[model samples]
Target chain A: MRARIVDKNDILKIVDILRKDHEVIAPFQGRGRDSFFDVVTDANRDQVKMHLHNPYYPPKRYVLPHIEKLFDIDQAKMDVKAAYVEPKRAIFGIRSCDVHGIYHLDRFYLGRDYKDPYYERLRRGLFLVNVVCTDKELDIDNGCFCMCANTGPASTEHFDLQLMDLGDVYMAVAGSPKGEALFADPIFKRGDDSHVQRRRSILNEVRKHFKLAVNWYSAAVRYITTGQVPEELWAQVGNRCLECGACTYLCPACTCFTVADRKVDGKVVERVRLWDSCALSGFTRMAGGHNPRRAVHDRRNRRFFRKLAHYFVQRELSMACVGCGRCIDVCHGDIGMPSVVEIIRRGCAGKENDSTIIKR
Target chain B: MTQPSSNDKNIYLPKVAILDRVQDEIQEVKTFFWHFENPADQEEFKKFRPGQFAQVSIFSQGEFPASLPPSPTEKETFFTVRTVGSVTSGLHQLKAGDKFAVRGPYGNGFPMEQYYGRNLVFVAGGIGLIPLRSCIIYALANRDRYKKIQVFYGSRSPRELMYTQNLREWEKIEGFEFYTTVDRGDADWKGNVGVVGSLFKKPDVKVPVENTTAFVCGPPIMFRFVIKDLKDMGFHDRDIVSTLERYMKCGVGKCGHCCIGMAYVCTDGPVFTYEQIKKLGEDI
Candidate 1:
C-alpha cells in the first residue's frame, strides 16, 4: 500500500529494473487494433505500449502454457522423469480481469486437495504488473463488462505492482514486498495523499466508459444454479454455436486440457498436455464410442454451467468468468457470456415463447 | 523461489511396473498380472479399495484409465483391458516381463464396510464384471459380515464370458447362489439360455428385495432394462449402485475431461447410486 510517482516518459524504467532480475513481458500493438504480449528485450523495449486493447490471448498461458511437457520416458530403461520449466518472468501491463483470472487458476490448481505440480512451478516464478484501464479510446471496449463482473476498472488486490495514469505522472502502488523493492530506483519519487485522491477520481471517471454495463450477472448465476433456464433456451443457444472452441481458448479462466504421449527419436517418449475445449465432440467420447455429452446443446450447456453455477463458484471461491470479454470478441456464433446471459434473462421473463428471442 | 527437489512427489509421474503373467479371459480381452518394480510402491498400492481405478501407461502409445480388477486382499494386482483403443491395443501386444508404468488407486471406491450384514446382489454383462470382481472377492473374504450373496452374469455367447475360473469357484461355495446366462447358447452350453434378467424370475431362484443392495454394470441397454427390473422389484434408487466410464486424461481431479454436471467423476465418484446418477443429468 505504498505509493510513488514516476514521470510518464520514464515508465519503461520500471520494466528495465524488473528485466534485470526477470524476463519482463509487456503489451505491444500488432496489426490495426490488435495487441499481443511478448518478451521486452533491448530491441523491442522501446515498442512496449503503456496503453492498448487487452490482448485476445490471455496471459494465463505464461503461467500455464498451451502445451506443457509432463514427463520424459526412457523407453529402454522404463524410466519416467517429471519435467518442468520455471523461468523467472514478469508480465507488465496486465489488465485487472486477467489478474483475477490467475487467482481463479490458483484456487483450482493449488487450493484443491491435489496440487498440480506443473502449474505450481510456473506460477511460483510469475510477477504481475497490473495496469488500470483509464483510456476510453484504447482500453475500454463495447464487449467489456468488468464493472458488472466486479474485477475492474482497477483491481483492489492480487497484483504485485499496480500502475495508474495521471496525465503527466504515473502513480504506482506496491502490493507486495518484491514490488516495493523497485521504489528504491531513482526513477521513482515518493507521493502523498493528494496523488491517491487523483487515482480515486480517475478510476471513477473510467468506470463510466464501459458501454456494455448491466447488473444481470447475479440473476443469470441464480437461474443457472437453480436449473430454471429451460432446455429450449439452451437448444436455441446451441443452434447458433459453430463449435470452433475459440470462446474457451480465448478465455482467461478456462483450464481444461488433454494429455498424449509421443515417441521421440524412437528411443524415448514424451507425455505432453495440450489445452482442450469442452465444446469439442471428442472431449467426452470414451474409447468404445460412448459419449455422455453427444448433443451439441449439452456441450453448450456445460460451458456456462461450469462458470455461472453456484456449486463451481463455491468450490473454487471465485467465479470462472472474469468479464474480460475475450469470448465476446472471439466467438463466431454470438453466444458469448453477455449474449448467453441476455438470452437467459429474456427466457426467464416468459419471452422464450416469442420466436424473436427464442427462434424455434 | 526454490526449485523442486528430486525426491518431491510428482502426482503425474508413474512408477515402473513389470508384467508377471497374462491370461486371455475372452476374445480381444486379456487380464495382465503386474507389480510395481519397487516394493515400497507395491506396498502403497495394496491399500487401494475396490471400485477404484489406475492410470496405465504404455510408453509410446499413451495412458488410459483401467479398473483395478484385483481386490486389496487378493494376492496380485492386475488390469483386465479389452482392446478398444490404440493405448489398449499396445498393452495387448506386450508379453511377459514387459515393463510399463501405473499411477493411482484414484476415485471414491465403493464403501463396502457400510453395507455390512446386508444381502448382496451382483449383476454383470460381458466385460462389466471387471470392476465388480474386486468387490465380490472382498466380500467373500469377509463372508461372515454379510448374510447372503447372489451373482448373475450374462454374455453375448458362451465364449465371451469373463472370469470363468472365478465363476466356476463361486458356483461351488455351498451357501452362495451363482447364476450364468448367455444371449445365444452353443451346443455345449446348458446352464441358462436367456438374458441376465431372466434369472431373476426363475422358479427355483428367489432374489431378496429387503435389506439387499444390487450392483449393476453392463452395456447401456442392459443397464436400462436391469434398472427397470430392480425398480419393479421394489428396490430403492439408493440401493442400486453402478460405476461410470468416461474419457479421462488425468486420473486426478485436475483435468476437466471427466466432469459431469457439478461433480468430477474422478473425485466425486466413478461409483454412484442410481439416485445420484439420475441427478448427473447425463446419459449412462
Candidate 2:
C-alpha cells in the first residue's frame, strides 16, 4: 500500500480516535529543556510537542517499569499470587532511536529463550505511533549518535504508524497492520514521489546536526573482543568514573534489576523488582561476604566488556548499545560509551606505534 | 545445564514452606529443615541436585539464596544458614511451623555425572562447609559410582566448626578420609591446628593432585590460598570445581545483579570450574 499524506489537524484527529479506545501517550515539554511522555487528555491536547526533542528518558518504563511487583504472598494462607497488569495504550510522537531501543528491549526480553510474561503482556497490548526526525534543533541534538548506531533519523521497520514531516503536511506510512487501519478514514491520502524525496532530504539534513562524530564503535569492538586494549587505559577510565550509575540508568538498553521483599502487614508480603546498576560495589556480593568485581576498575571493565565483547554481543544477538548517547549527558565522569570508545581508539593507536618502534 | 527459566509457574512466585525443625550448628550458624506446605510441591521440590540453592523468604524480611545443605538423596531438605545480615537473622528468629516462601533450586548445581569416576577432594572453611556437605553426602550415597573421597575442613576455632555430627560419621565410614583442623585451637581442642591447606601436609592425607577433581568453597582469603596451594601441587584449573555465591535478586538470569562479564552466576553457574572462573574476568 502507498504511504499517505496527512495534515497536523488530521494527525490530531487520529490521536482523538485512538484516545477513544486506547490510552494515548504523547511527548510533552516538562520543565525547562526536559521533555517526557505523558497521557494525552483533552485539556493537554495542545501541549503535545509534535516536533520534538528526544525525551530525557526512553519509553522503556512503559514496558519494564522502575518498580514492578512480581508477586504477593499471604502469610496466613501460605499462598503467592503474581501481580501482573497489562494495559492497552498507544504512544504518539516517539522518535526513531527510541523505537529502535524498544525493538532492542523486545529482542532481549521476549525474543530470548524465556519470554517475560509481564513484559510480553504490556508489549502485546501496546500501539506505537513513531515520528521521523526532521527538526535538527527539536529532534536531533548534540548528544545523539543514532546515525553511527545505525538506528536513527528514521526507522526502517517496527512501528505502527510512522509519521514524517513535509513542512506543512505529514507523510504517514503503515509499518504494521494496526498502522494501516488508520488510513481507512479520509484523514490520510496517498503520498506521491515528491513526499518520499522530501523525507530523504530532511533525514540527510539531521544527520549533519550530530555534534560529535563516532567512527570508533566498530573499531573499538575489534580491540575489545581481541582483549588487546591495555589495562592501563581501563584503569585511567576507572579512575575518572565516579560510579554515580547515571550512565547505565540513562542508557536505554541497560536492563538490570534487583528483587526485594517488604512486609505489607503481618498477613501479606510484597516482592518488588527495582532497577539495579552493575557499577555499584554490592552488585556481585555473595551472602557470607565474597564479591567478584569488587574493585572499582574491575566493575568498570565489566560494563564495557559486557556491552562490546563478541561472545556477549553474540548472545544478545545485537550490540547492547544502540548509541543513543544519552549516557554522555548523564555521566559526571565523562566516561560514557562515546568517550570510552575514543579512549580505546587512542590506546590502540599508541600500542601500534610502540610495536613499530620496537620492530625498528 | 544452562536452564534459562525452565519453571512453568511464574518464576518469582514462591511456594510456601513450613520450617519443620531447627538446630544450632555453631554459634552463628543454624540448620533449618523445611517441607513444602503442599505435599505435592514437596515431592516436586525434592528433585534438586547438590550445590543448588533456594531463595528463602521470611515474610517480614527479604529473600536470600541459602545453600541446600541436605542432598536430594536425604529425606529432609534443609538450609544451613549463618546469621550474617537481616534476612538471614530473620530466618534465625523463625521457629518450627513458622511459614516462609521458597522458590528455586536455582543455578547450575555440581556436575555430579562428570565427577563420577574421578578421585574426589572436597575442601571447605568456616560455614563455607554448608554447600560442600551436600556434595560429600551425595558422593558417599552414590559411593560405587565414584573413587576415593577425601574431605578437609577448617574453622577459626573448635566452637565455630559446622556439621560435627556428619563429620563424625564420615570419619568412621570406609573408603573416606576425613580430616578436621582449627586455625587456633582451644583448651579442649585436640585436632590439627592450621589452615585447611595445612591438612594436605599430614601423613594420612595424600591429596592426589592428578586424576582428581577438587571442590573448594570457603571465604575469599581461604579460597585464594587453597587455590594457590593446589596450583603449586599441580591441579589443572579445569579439574577444580567450586560453587560461587553472588548477590542475587531473581534466581533467574533476568536480574543482572549476579552477572560477571558475560555469564550470570544465577544461571550459567553458582557451580563452575576454575578454568571458567578465570575466564569470567572478575575478582571471585
Candidate 3:
C-alpha cells in the first residue's frame, strides 16, 4: 500500500472516526509545561494536541497500568480467579521513543517461557497511532537521548498508523493491515515522493535539535560489560542517588513490579502488582533482612549495568533505555541515566569528576 | 527459555492448598505441610525439586517466596517459613484445614545431576537451612550416588536451632557427619558453641576442596564470612554453591524486585555458584 497524506482539515476527522468505535486516548496539555496522556473524549476532543510535549510518564500505562489487580482470592472458598480484562483502545499521537518503549516492554512481558496474562490481556488488539518526532518540539524534553538509544525521529514498525508533519498536510504511513484499513476513509490520498523528500530534509534539519545526545553509549556498554567501571565511580554515583526510585518509574523501559494482597473488604482480597524500582534498598532484600546490594552505589550501579551492559542488552535483544529522559525530571538527587552515563563517559575518558551536578 | 510448568494455567495464578500440618522448627520458624484440596493437584505438584521455592499465599495477607523445604523423595510437600515479615506473620496465624494459594517450584534449583560424583558439604546459618533442607534430604535418600555428605549448621543459641529431630536422626546415620553449634551456649546445651564456621575446627569435619561442592546459605554477614572461609580453605569460586533470597513480587522474572545486575534471583538462581555470583556484579 502507498503512503498516504492527511490534510490538516482531515486530522480531527480521523480521530473522530477512531473514537467512534474504540476508547481514544491522546496527548493533552497539563498545567504549564507538563504534558499528559489523557483519555480523550468528545467534550475534550479539541484539547488533543498532536505536537504537544511528550507526557512525563511513558504511555506504558495503557498496557501495564501503574497498579493492576492480577487475581482475586476468596479465603473461605479457597479459589483463585485471574483478573484479566482486555479492552480495545486507540492510542493516538504517541512519539517514536514511546513506540520503542512499548516494543521493549513486549520483549519482556511476552517472554519466550512465561508470558504475563494480565499484560497480554491488556496488550491484545491495541491500536497505536504514532506521530513521528522530527525534533525536540513535540514533547522531547531537555534531557532526551533517543538518538543514541536508536529509537528516534520515526519508527518503521509497531505503529498501526504513523504520521509525519509536512506543513500543510501530514504524511501518513501504514505499518500493518489495520493501519491500511484506515486509509479507506477517503480523507487520505497517496503521498508523492516530494513529500518523502521533505520528510528526509526535515529529519536532517531536526537532527541537531536534541538538548541531550549520547555519543559514548557503546563506550559505556563496553566499560560496564567488561567491569572496567571503577568501584569508586559506582560509590560516587550511589552517593548522589537518593534511592527515591522515581527514575525507574518514569523510565519508559523499566518493567519491574512488586505484588501484594490488598483487602477489599472482610472476605474479599485482590493481589495487585505495583510498579517497583530496583533503586530502593528493599527491592533485593530478603525476608530475613539480608540484602546483597545494600549500598546505595550498588543499587545505582546495577540499574545502569542492567540497562546498558552488553550481556543484558544482548539477552534482552534491545537496550532497555529509549533515552526518553523522564528520569531526569523525576530525579531529586540528579543521578538520572544521562547524568550517570556522562559520569561514566568522563571517567572512561580519564577525567576525574568529583560531584553530582544536574544540568539540562 | 525454560519450559513452562503448566501450559494451560497462568504462571502467576496460584493453586489452592490447605495447610494440613505445622511443625515448630525453632522459636521463629515453623514447617507447614500443605496439600491441594484436589487430589489431582497433588500429583502435578509432586514434581517440585530441591532448592526451588513456591509463592505461599494468605488470602488478604499477601504472598511470600518460600523455599520448598521437603525433599522430592518425601511424599508430603511443605514450606519451612520463618516469621520475618507481615506475610509470614499472617501465615503463622492460620491453622490446619485453613486454605491458601501456592504456585510454582520456581527458580533454577540445585543442579543435583552435575554434583553426582562430587562430595557435598552443606553449610547453613540459622534459618538459612530451610532451602538446603530439601537438597540435604535428597542427597541422603540417594546416598549411594554421592560420596561424603556432611552438614555444618549453626544458630544464635541452642534454642534457635531448627529441625532437631531430623538433625539427630541424620547424626545417627553411619558415615553421615552432622555438626551443630551455637553462637552462645545454654545451660542444657552440651556441644560446640560458636558461629557455623567454628564447626570446621572439629577434627572430624574435613571439607575436601577438590572434587567437592560446598553449598552455603545464611544471613548476609554469615554468608560473607563463610564464603571467605571457604576461599581461604582453597575452594574455587565455582566449587562453592549457595541459594540466594530476595524480595520478590512475581516468582517469574518479569517482576524486577529479585534482579541484581543482569540475573533475577527468581529465575537464574536462588541457586548459583560463587563464580557466577561474582560475574553477576551484584553483591551477595
Candidate 4:
C-alpha cells in the first residue's frame, strides 16, 4: 500500500479527480438524521459531506440494483436480447462495513460455478473509495457493531482507496493500482511514518465509541451451525417481525432476487429481476400453494441459519452479516442481528446438553 | 460509456427452442416436444441425465422450472407440463411452430447407473410420473444392465392418468411389469380400483425387497404412505429415491427460493434419497 497526505479542505479535489472519468457518488445529509448516497454533479458537489452518519440504505444497489432488466424478448421475431449495462462509476465515501458487503457479494455472484453476468458487469465497472469511521460524533451510530464483525473502522483491503480524517490533514492509503495512480496528482503529497502512527491511534480511540458491541457472535455461530437453537426462541423472534422486508433490503449482504417478465409493448417483453427477501411467505410458496416454510418462525429461522450457519459461511468464505447494523436502523421490531444474537445466547445458556428441538 | 455487449455464454440467457409437436397426456397435462433452434445447443443438451430439470421461459408470462421428461436415449427432448400457473398456461397456448426459450438441465439428476443388476420399482401418483418417466425409459432402453423392473402408477380417476401411450407399450413388454390403479373406477374401467400402494399387496405381484431400489414420486400424502410401506417391506432409507419440487426463479443456484436448510435443491439436489431428505429438516 502507498500512503499520501492531503490538506483537509482538498478532500473535494479527490472527488473532482474521480469525476473526470467516473460518475462519483457520495453521501449527503438529508432531513433531520437521514443521509443518502447520490450522484455528485457540478451543482451539488460541494454538498457531499466528508463527515456524516452512514446511510441506512446500503450501496449494494450500485452493483445489484433494486430492479434490473435481464433481457428483452421480441415476440414477433422470437429473439431474446440480453440487457447489459456497465457504467464507469466510483462510489466515494463508502464505509468499511459496506465495502465488506460488496466483497461478500463478489464471493457469491462471481465465485460460483455459474457467474451472474448482470452482477459481473456492474461489479467490473465499480471503483470503491472507503472512508474510515474515525469521527465518533458523526460516523459512529449507536446501532453499529462493526467492531464485533471485525470489518471496520478501517478495512484492510477490497477498496481501491481508503481515506481517514486526522484533524489537520487527511491520510490516504492506496489499496489497488487504480488508487496508486492518483498519487501523481499535485494535491496529494508523500506521507511519512507519523501519518501511519496517527491513523492507528485514531482508530484505537474511535473503537471505544460504539454503543452496541455484540460479544456473543461466535457463540451464536456455533449454536446455529450445530442446530442447537430452540424453536421457541425463533418463534419469539419471528413474532416481533412485521415482515416489511426492511431488514433484508437495508442489509448489505442479502443477495436473493426473483425474476419476472413484463410486457413493454405489444411486440416486446422485458424480463426483469427484483430484490427478494426470505421474510415474505410468498417467497418460498409454490404455485399450487404448498409452502415449506409457511410459518413466520420458520422463515425467520432461515434468515439466521443462512447468515450464521457454518456450511454457508464456509461456502461463501465470509459471514453473510457484515455487522453494518443497517438492519437495526430499518427494523420496525427489535429483531436485528445483535438483538437476535443476544436472544440466542440467553436461550441456550443452561441448555447446552439438552436435546435441541427445531420444528419445521 | 460504451454499451456492453451480451456474453455468449451468459447463464441467464435462454436459447430459443422450436416446438416440434404437442401431445395431450391428461386433462390439463401436455407433453411438449421441442429442440433448440441452434444445432450447437441441441447437441450440448443431449448430454442431460434423467431427473434433471430446465428453466422454460414463455415470452410474456414468466420463467418456471420444468423437469426434462425425455431420456437421453430418446430421440427428442420434451417437457411434460400440467397447466397449473400462468407460465404453463402460456405454454399451453403455443402452436407446433411457436418458439420459447430453455436453459439448463440443472440439479443433480438420478444416479441410475449405480443400480446395476438391481431390481427397480417406480411408484408414481398422477403428474408425479413426469420426472420418473425419464429414468423409466432409460432403464428400459438399457434393460440388459438391470434385473426385474416394475412400475406402479395411480391417479385420482381414469382420465387423470398420464403417459397412456407409454403405459400401453410397457404392458406388452415381456420382462417389464406395469400396474395401474385409480382412487375411484369409472364404468368401463377394469384395472385395480385402489391406491397405488395396494398394488404391492397383489398375490401374483412380487416386489423384491432384498436387492431393490424404490423410486417414489407423488403428492405428499402418497409419498408418506408409500415410504411407510417400503420401510415395512425391509427397504433401507438410502435405497429409496425421490425428486422434489419447489418454487424456483433461477435454474442455477443463485436465487434462494429452492434452498432447504443447508442445501440448495437446485444445485445440491432435486434428486435425493430418503435418508438425505430426512436430514434436510424441511417438509417436502
DockQ of all predictions against the true structure, Cα-based: 0.77, 0.55, 0.69, 0.79
Q: In model 3 chain A, where is the ten-residue run with the lowest total lDDT?
A: A351-360
For residues B1-284, write the lDDT of model 4, one tens digit per residue. 11134545688888889999999988888999999888878988999999999999998889899998889999899999988888999999998999998889899899988999999999999898999999999999999999999999999999898888888899999999999999999998999999999999999899999889999999999999999999999999999999999999997888889999888899888999999999887778
The local distance difference test score of each candidate is 0.90, 0.83, 0.84, 0.91
lDDT of 4 at B176: 94
lDDT of 4 at B168: 89
A291 Cα displacement, candidate 3 (Å): 3.8
How does model 2 score on DockQ?
0.55
A183-257 in candidate 3: lDDT tens per residue? 989899887889989989887877788878655788788778867789998999999988888888888798988
| Better model by lDDT: candidate 3 vs candidate 4 | 4
Candidate 2 Cα deviation (angstroms), residue A87:
0.3
Residue pairs with backbone atoms closer than 3 Å in model 1 (clashes): none
The candidates, ranked best first by lDDT, are: 4, 1, 3, 2
Q: Candidate 2 regions off by >4 Å?
A: A263-267, A285-291, A352-360, B1-8
Highest DockQ: which candidate?
4
Scanning candidate 2 chain A in windows of ten residues, the lowest lDDT window is A349-358
Give candidate 4's fnat, 2 decimals.
0.77
Q: What is candidate 4's local distance difference test score?
A: 0.91
| Structural RMSD, model 3 | 4.4
